[model samples]
Target: MRLTGTLDPVYNLRYVDSVNVSYYNNRLLPGGGRITVSVPVHNNRFSAWVPPLPAGDRLVLRLRYPEMPDSAGRILDVGGVSLMTGDSIVELSIGKGTYNPRLKKFALKADVVTGEQNIARLAYLGAMRLRNNITDTLRKKLYEKTIDSMAYNTAMQKASELRDSIDRDFIIRHPSSLQSLNILETIIGRYLNKQGGWNASGNKRLTEIDNLLQALDRSLRDSEKAQHLITSLDRAREMKLIPFTGIMPDGSVFDVASLEGKVFLIDFWGSWCGWCRKSHPHLKELYEKYKDEGFEIIGIGEEFGTGKEQWDRFRKAIAADGITWPQILNDPARQDVVSDYMVQSFPSKFLIDRNGKVVLRVLGDSEGLLDAKLKELFGK
Candidate 1:
């Protein structure tokens, strides 16, 4: 597709030697690749031909100025463009704009030649802006130590609900929009790592996401990516442990099945993770308090690599932290198991019941949520 743009000098365009342009397609996939190109700027004007977007796959464009900073001195995650029309000719005139209070970000207004795609682009901008605002606020709170991990997680969940509400409104208003389908897929995918199991609120979010997907244009709902997302949502509803054999630190085979019919915690952590190291003390306390009561803890150490240096670091960390629990390294043989468990972040904990069901899943507990659960279970 033909792309041409003139930038406003107010954005300090003179300092922007060139713009980094990239486009993302098949974004619903777990590992989608981005194609990027560098285009030079001359006298605040630049033009280039971007590849056409394939059908049923939404394409999102992004621009970065490696040397340019916004007036706030922040290289704001600046500009966005969402293209729904296939191979449509488009033109843009971009300019620096005032900070929008509602979206809580400094804005960049783009005058596009194609009106429909422009509206979709604006909707994408709004959704992303709101998401960034919420994320920034949470990060600030966490950085200031104003909120613990449990409260931070709770706030993040609330933020997700707010985003879903906004997306719901956008979908209802523009059921035919590909951006709406994108938003629906995002909502459905969020349930993959959601902490609580299929509880009341979880079921509500599932129903809401499914209903919104059905509300979209039939072409979008039937697309390959959308169908994949729907299948993923169905799988997320039936969560369970993937039984596997883990190799303990002493080179002995440890089958997770042996822990069945017992309450235990599976901790996916790494030695390099600061928060994981911090929680070691609390976990030790809990282990000592409840080991006699049929409670157990399993630590899956995900090191940077399986080299000798990495193993030394892992073992040294366990010794230094005084971790007495059975620790396993997520080596090549068990990497697939970690993938099966969908451990996307460090310090992911899955609390399993006697029946081997995942009662709760949390990331970076910081000793609050897990402590409470243990107390409720063992009456300590």
Candidate 2:
């Protein structure tokens, strides 16, 4: 493959040794091999031949500039290169890249044009723009105040809408492209363990994901990455319908199915998690106010330390905090309780109605929303 790009005229190219190109088998994984080749530079333009790479490999190019002496100290510029490649002639320009003086690295911003159809490139670009925009908006909001459940839920809703829009517009346009498969894989991995937000219509969303997977090219659908995505969706669906059993802190057996006749909550938490502890008071109040009205909660503690010691400590802490709900301590050996619920993060919660159907699932405390939902389920 041929690599051609222009170097900044401000930097002397004499100190440059060779341009480095790195490729990873899977862009999702880290630690890949690198290939470096010396290229001739004449009048700020450089051309080099990259040894033929494997048919499908993600590429990254790096250019480090020479250090120059200044009044304050020595300054150096390193250009970060982002590129998309395919079996064809590729051209790139790098002049307006962002540079970090401390790390001496420059970040090059470029849209990659791969061997896939132009539609694939457009989809990738559009999706990336929406992702970055959502990230920036949330970052700014986070600086102003602590992120509460409402703010986080709202931001997540907006992001889900953006993702759905990208999928509907782009993936549908090029269902057979590898680019489309990659985009779908990303979305699948993101919500694999999450059941709420955009995934509120649990079974319907799972069905849609399955349909998309089936829509891919036969070869691509049978690939390892595709299989993994399919498996994740299946597991999430199965877990939603499965009833879990655990041992309470007091050595009593606790079965989730036993609480089928009441509106209940499955609170997955950890002692080490600050948010889990912070939410205890509100949960306690809700329990006390609604206990006689058939409101029940099953606290599932995700213990990381020795089971007995951690369980004892957690019991003491809950008592001290006035949490009188039934507590189920996780058995590290048999962790299906956590896995069945797809509890990736602490403070995960699921609200179930009298029929044992999940009404809501959220990562953090649902705050007033939980209270509101309980009231709706069992009127105060």
Candidate 3:
């Protein structure tokens, strides 16, 4: 597939070094795939030969503008711009796309390349429009104090359900498409919460999901990505802890078995999660108070991008937060633990008893559930 594009010089072409074209790979398993190929940009124009993508494959074309200044003059990498793929060649124009610095999101304008690309583009844009409209409405209501926090959350849930219906319709209509499989995976994640638990409606959703998968083309149904999705579904129903090993930030191996026979907490968090970092002080207090009482906390740091910068952020967050617990990093080289846990959100935790059984699993702090449970366990 030949991909050629021109960026509007207004985007400050000097900052953009290349364009990164990322596409779906069903074989990578567990987390789906984000295979990226970088094409160098010169004079605001760039071209590259991308491997042919299977039908229904999702594509995201993004600018590699390091530290590009936003409207607010804040320096940061812009969020990726999703693109529709054509069969042979694609030509895009980065027209007067708007950038919201506060949200760190950018939009792009692409020329009508082919019928396939147009259909995909419309579906993508429709979803985005739905999300943006709902978000804008909610923001207006909140700013005007028309609704309280509880009401806001409830409305957000409804908005999510609305979007899920749209995705469901798309998948049912395009079962054989690879994009259908990708959308199915996302819907599955939403059904399975951060703690690997699902609600009463989950059973029905799972059955429907299975039917959808079977309706897919035989080739896609038999693909590795489909198999991974099936495995995840099974795990959601009969959720059990997966014993694994990980590399610590200090280059040491940490085994889950090491914490056996102790009342411990498995915290899945990332430096980018504000709520996770905010809870550090409380966690520090709990650890220091319960360490001698056979209580332990193992942090599974799920860093974003791999490299010195991300590692540094992880370490810096640890130091700044004064966290002293044993931390296991889930980098590219070691994503097994995170993948095994099926962690969908930050600050997901499992409170295990001395018998190595998960007594309580919660996303976020769970409104002091951790503290109350710990108090009961250790009689603090």
lDDT of each: 0.69, 0.65, 0.72
TM-score of each: 0.61, 0.51, 0.72
Per-residue error for 239 in candidate 2, Å, reads 11
Per-residue C-alpha lDDT of model 2 across residues 223-242, encoded as one tens digit per residue: 76577567656655544434
Candidate with best TM-score: 3
RMSD of each predicted structure: 7.1, 9.2, 6.1
In candidate 1, where is summed lDDT lowest over 10 consecutive residues? 24-33
Tens-place lDDT digits, model 1, residues 273-355: 99888888888888888889999998887776435656788899999998888888776544445555656667788788888
lDDT comparing candidate 3 with the true structure: 0.72
Clash count in backbone of candidate 2: 2
Model 3 lDDT tens row, 34-95: 66789899988999787765554557777776665565232233556566554577777665
Ranking by lDDT: 3, 1, 2
**What's the true lDDT of residue 244 in model 1?**
72
Model 3: CA > 4 A from native: 4-47, 51-80, 84-108, 115-118, 146-157, 194-202, 288-293, 304-306, 353-359, 372-380
- Pitting candidate 1 against candidate 3, the one with the higher TM-score is 3
